[model samples]
Target: MGADGTPTVMVVDDHPIWRDAVARDLAEDGFNVVATADGVASARRRAAVVHPDVVLMDMRLPDGDGAQATAEVLAVSPSSKILVLSASDERDDVLEAVKAGATGYLVKSASKQELDDAVRATAEGRAVFTPGLAGLVLGEYRRIAKGPDATSAPSLTERETEILRYVAKGLTAKQIAARLSLSHRTVENHVQATFRKLQVANRVELARYAIEHGLDE
Candidate 1:
């Protein structure tokens, strides 16, 4: 969230028109458009300054690809949630962005409403993705879980584990709270605790950990 309470956003696209349009839409939709960047270097520089709540990233940039930009930006602004807004939905691209710490992936074909909702969700720590892209990400994690290097992870409490399962299933804190008859704040606390215990930054990584450990089942 921004200092003014609305989610702060940074638009990173090589295309000037598209970048401005996205910034305008987000601004009109109640987001604080803190900054705009055209390439990886600018994205990292601006992100370091604004530390926005969400970054609307483009897959292709003047200097590098979205994966590179995502990584660089997060390296500077670790708390900023990245939401890829790419025209390509290729499996490799999606996977690269996710591995680079993108919290969500939305294609260019998404409606304005969809984009608005996705940005809001991303700011709130939810992992939003284009419909099929989510399954692709989760399946990749499951495959990685079979690897020998996936053995050790930090331990989580039983309650935290239960909450993690719901998170892996893509449930929001409010929804998980309703399911468990707990307060939303309580659910968020458990999620935060899980994040700390796993040393993961966001819900996307937490979900990946859960799937890797076969907790999503």
Candidate 2:
């Protein structure tokens, strides 16, 4: 948490000027500006340390895509919320970020007030998207929801199910490992394998899987 009890945030855009501007605005809004990263590697490294409550990232970084970095960050800080803040509002970009476990998506054109509010909403676990993008994401999810039932879904090991319950409860991988008496790497491995088996792109979908299967109970 931040000094004012607001959530801590990380800005992960390659452009220093835009990144700094966002960071400054967030800081001014009483959010704890934890750290800023220019690329995927640095984002992962800083995120591991700060374990920020929310991450604001651009879709295209100098080294990689924001969606990929979102997955990597969640792999390390499972409880962190990622919010894609990019210039592009294309449907593909929005869906990709959501599939990558982003809690929200906002374009760079958003006003500082809008960005601040979105950050707060994301920290509280709300799925935020730039005006029209939210409808598209929801429609995609609804389409996917009709494709499979949890019962007929691919099978998972007992351990995967156990870890997934904690995931659904919003526990970080580190926290889940501590509770289950498992190594960090072991838990992460299970999560990755589960991702492959379920064909879910990221943690958000993983949570949905748990809910659909009643594992979240």
Score each candidate by Cα lDDT: 0.74, 0.71
Q: Highest lDDT: give the candidate number.
A: 1
Spell out the clash pairs found in candidate 1: none
RMSD of each: 5.5, 11.1
The sequence of per-residue lDDT tens digits that candidate 2 reaches over residues 35-151 is 999999999999999999999988888888887899899999999989888765454655566677776677888888889888887787664543234343333433444565444
Cα error, candidate 1, residue 195 (Å):
12
- The Cα RMSD in angstroms, rounded to one decimal, for candidate 2 relative to the true structure is 11.1
Runs in model 2 deviating more than 4 A are 142-217
Query: Tens digits of per-residue lDDT for model 1 on 111-186?
Result: 9998998898789887664434444444454454455545543456678767666766777767889999999778
Range of the 10 consecutive residues with the lowest summed lDDT in candidate 2: 207-216
- What value does the lDDT take at residue 126 in candidate 1? 71
